[model samples]
Target: MGVYDKMGKVTKATRSRAEEIVDYVASKGYKLTRIWGMGSSGSEHPTGRALDFMITGPGLGMVVGNLIASYLWKNRKRLGVKWVIWDEHIRSTSPGKSGRWEDYRGASKHEDHVHVFFGTGAYVAPPVAGGGGGSAVKVVDLSQLIEAAERDTDRKQGGTTPGAADDVKIVEAALKAEGLLSARYARDGSFGSLTVKAYSKWQESKAGGSYRGKDSDGIPGRKSLERLGKRNGFKVRS
Candidate 1:
């Protein structure tokens, strides 16, 4: 099976990275399932710069997850990874710095998948399977990488209060980021029925409840707002 076989629409750079990861995993004697690509969201996925590889069976363990995440983090520069989210932690290379794995409170929690986002204008040169003219390749052991990643501090979940027009706009942006709201929502810092409907849809989708339900109501409460803000990487303020 080819890497791009079932993968949806993504940019060439993202495809290149996905191909490399797929080949590497296969070479390590692992079976890869779905690799999702584009969706109608403000996230990198819609921009063709993100890919989600669903992990299953033995690959669902934290050790394996950390291994893959650590390998990508170690070679983020060459791999063009803007950030990586696996299990419930996130690591980003946008600021050219490395930090502890921070908690990611998205509805998915990415427990079933590994998400990778490529940096803007960054690309990973394709691997040469049998070519003889390349430099020595470093082999990263799964056990070693897992241990290293585990040593990092488990960062806390981040969020801010919501009580102003800016807060509403943040919520709107986050909803758009997750593909929950269409462009029609306008994100005009005004919370209208459209925003309520969109947010309620999102809530129902994540929490499996009705929009009018106490938990999924269109109102932007603390917990729901925090989840949306953290999931979409938005700055929520009071």
Candidate 2:
């Protein structure tokens, strides 16, 4: 068996899951900057159930990092993903806390990679589809998007609204494409002051020039969102 993070043999399940993650990233046309498995003694790493895939790409890597996190979360049960950490936050498959991205108090902010832990059930590797499929266009929910944005704005610093990361990330991706938001902050799934400022700039642009003053207050309006969706590959659902 191959060495696990230069320590020793990892469980079949852990090995399979780690391979799948790497393959998945490759299929998306991006590469993981680095991967670590089975090191820390008290953690899942030593037990061979944890893996850390450092993210890097065209722009500081956060975009693909977000994509990987989203994919793992979406397929948590199917892939036996027990827990995940990225960008200073954690999400778990545990009851009452599933899908909730809460602040991570750990020393590592995890901004540069995605840390995943799989349950024992991930023994047999799932079939990994091949080829570089560009980023998938997510279907954005307008109500949830607005709610998430408003809730995020209430925060004094970086934080995400519950159940809002995916949708917010989609919106942020659109904003980034418009050159309004920096890639570094675009994929973290937060709609803080920076996102608000970016959205305002988007509204003032020619494409959304119809909005003015209160209408262009940075909270995405139906028309402006629709227009953005048209240009971005996402569909806005009301």
Candidate 3:
């Protein structure tokens, strides 16, 4: 059967971008079990600019949901995507800040579905400033980072000793850059629960179309850490 077979009856209308997203997913041989296009007042769904792919499958449903989210983020410009929310995380294609998967603390955690919003205008890339000489890229030790996180039971504000959480600070800064952690907690240098949760979300964003529960265990892994470092102008030494 085709992808439409899995989609239940849709009561409300949808925009072109939402339809394109469904077509793209179907082209990739993926199935979206259920979809809802209408919402109550003050929602984009009623205006046909938003849709919720109520995905249900084996495991946490994060596998297929992440695939859809990542695809939408990567080709957002062409797809006219405003933002994507799934599994308690949200990524926006905003003007200045794009591709930062922040922790979504909305009313709905969106643990079981992937929500997408489309913009009316064409996607515009943020202006990049000119620079002459490039500075040295910072390096973080993954081993030390994992060790600190493992022993970070206090989950407090700062570190006990000076520079004790330096490596963690580096990673936290990266996470903040990705919008996963807020600025208030970005430089605390503590691998606490919040930081762990943010890192776990980051881990879940990768691997194309696979569920990554083990990798998203809030522990730092080499491959995922390296990817983060590469994106944020840092080097990871394991």
Candidate 4:
């Protein structure tokens, strides 16, 4: 089985995000590698919030005529996820900014995994300029985030506010970094109140590496992203 194939069970967020992503992919004639029917939403992308997808398949396009991987490749300017990692199938747009791509993962571990999720609110993100991988990778870890949500309803990750559509990657480059967690636990970057609580919890558990939380000012720094890049295995290039 592949990395994604081993995904124990799909979440509602991943499923919702995939629905929107697959629609656009179909235009390019690329087949979806995994149909995350049960995949729930996470902090990266909270429930009901759809987003671009991460490339889990071998390639976005290249098999046939319509298989021209150029669809995502050509529209690179609009999708930010590609700019951060450089994948075709796993594409995503900034939260709130519909149809606009920001690729915030940056040159971090998130560069490896695609975050098509919603809110969690709080995040720390990695420091890789132009890296869409922010501090919300934790959202993908549904189990951990779910526990945090029990305490708060809204996200604390600090983002464009609920139902705003403005997304924040809040990733670094890896999946293990707690700095990458999301309150709602998705990858779309919606950020809510609950996300904040999760981030604090993560901070308390950490030992060093200069822990920094989200700032509504919308300024992502470097030290904050250090672990972020390593998470996605992009530290070398980042």
Candidate 5:
């Protein structure tokens, strides 16, 4: 393909980054090759701003360095960036490149490419196995927590997070809601599979109710919430 060949699309925010990365590589005396490109903001693709780089000519991932990782690890604090895997089911922070990288082992498809995320760095790791609060005791803004619950994701794409919570927490809460013999809710607030399933169920249950939540794509919408308010003896507007 020509240089004009589309490697991938990206968020308008990353345009500078993408260009900088590409230019950085080109500056190294290498040619841009075809790489698997996903995420789109231009072509005006749906979803939020994102970049898709389809590097080719050379084998995939033949770049000089792990650009995304480098950015995350190096500038994590400066850029206010967070960490997720290149291709793993679970969303988590890298433990300084040597920690246990977690994911949804069975149903993950990030095998080919890594996903560097931005815009919403809202996932917190779940509390360790013990009852001790430790880092998990931190109070999360319920509003942000609900927003994470509303996101939908699957084999097609990674979940879009307005605000991400710990995948572990999401599982816990879903299980909590589900209780024994049922999947629990992700109390930690991370939107994992269990939470997604639970959210889907909640949305379905509310569809016909006077409280239609959001677009009901599983994201909590306003109507459903207002009804919840009324149930709690709070006034609800039509």
Candidate 6:
């Protein structure tokens, strides 16, 4: 199935890694199906750290699986891959080496899919260099926006001050990173109606009961921004 459908079975860390792997492999021209599967009792699947990718289409076989698995092993540290099982064999980070392919012996023997597990404290991939045709900026940190907001707050208390355009740009960047807003949404540093709509939609998705009704009224308040930061793997202070 689609990656989104399986995301609820795994932690956000696992979902991010799976999305990256799916995108990387798809760019190389491989069709993937199903990411989350309930493994046997006590398996990593049940713990939300494991995913399975089923490969379909002709001319794809063990050699293809080997190539995919090898690529994952090569980038294990960066991807926080704990282990990978494919074509009846498995390699893991536990030994910090790619072990020889032994007989998997489990059901399906992983002959049709590649399974990956994330390690504790999995790493999140940073934005790609030259992404968005060199026009799209990287995700903005909430702290930077907070600092600017504080400045704007101070200016407002003293005298009539212009709106915080920079804050809007930062929030737009965050929204773009989370796929809540399109790049064309104009990171022009203005908290216009468009920003409000986008921010409100994002808040609705979180729907943690803490920010509802007027609190979810489209303003980029501290609580919503903090939640957004945490969801995107940023460390935010309490």
Per lDDT, the best of the predicted structures is 2
Q: For residues 1-238, could you state the per-residue lDDT of candidate 6 as single tens digits?
A: 3545654556656665666666677777775665655553336778878777666545556666776788788878777888888987877777656465566777667877788887777344444345556433334445544444344334433221144464456566666555566556635565555656677777777532256787776755666776665544343332
Q: What TM-score would you give candidate 2 relative to the actual structure?
A: 0.48
Worst 10 residues of 4 by lDDT: 80-89
lDDT of 2 by residue, 77-182 (tens): 7678888999999999877885799999887889887888888763422322334754454578888878877888887576888887888888886776565776
The C-alpha stretches of model 6 lying farther than 4 A from their native spots are: 1-8, 39-42, 57-64, 95-108, 126-238
**Model 5 ranges with Cα > 4 A deviation:** 1-10, 27-29, 34-45, 59-67, 78-80, 87-100, 104-111, 120-238
Clashing pairs in 2: none
**What lDDT tens digits, residue by residue, belong to model 3 across residues 16-86?**
34444555566677756556665533377666567777667533266778878887788777657888998
Off by over 4 Å in 4: 1-167, 172-185, 201-226, 229-238
- The residue pairs found clashing in candidate 3 are none
C-alpha local distance difference test of each model: 0.59, 0.74, 0.67, 0.36, 0.41, 0.62
Please report the TM-score between candidate 4 and the true structure: 0.26
Write the residue-wise lDDT of candidate 1 on 78-165 in tens digits: 7777888888888877665466678888777888778888876635343223358754322222232222223211322212122233
Each candidate structure's TM-score, on Cα atoms with residue i matched to residue i, is: 0.48, 0.48, 0.42, 0.26, 0.33, 0.54
| Model 3 / residue 137 / CA error / Å | 1.6
Q: What is the Å distance of residue 237 in model 5 from its true position? A: 57
Could you give candidate 5's per-residue lDDT for residues 1-238 as a string of tens digits?
A: 6542453454433433344445545656765553333443323234333333443346445344355445444544433344434444434354454434565454434454444444432211222342563332322344554556544443223344554455324333323322211322323344645555554555555431432444445444455444333322222222
**Best-fitting candidate, measured by TM-score?**
6
List candidate 1 segments past 4 Å from native. 1-6, 40-42, 57-64, 96-98, 126-238
Q: Give per-residue lDDT, candidate 6, residue 171.
A: 63
Ranking by TM-score: 6, 1, 2, 3, 5, 4
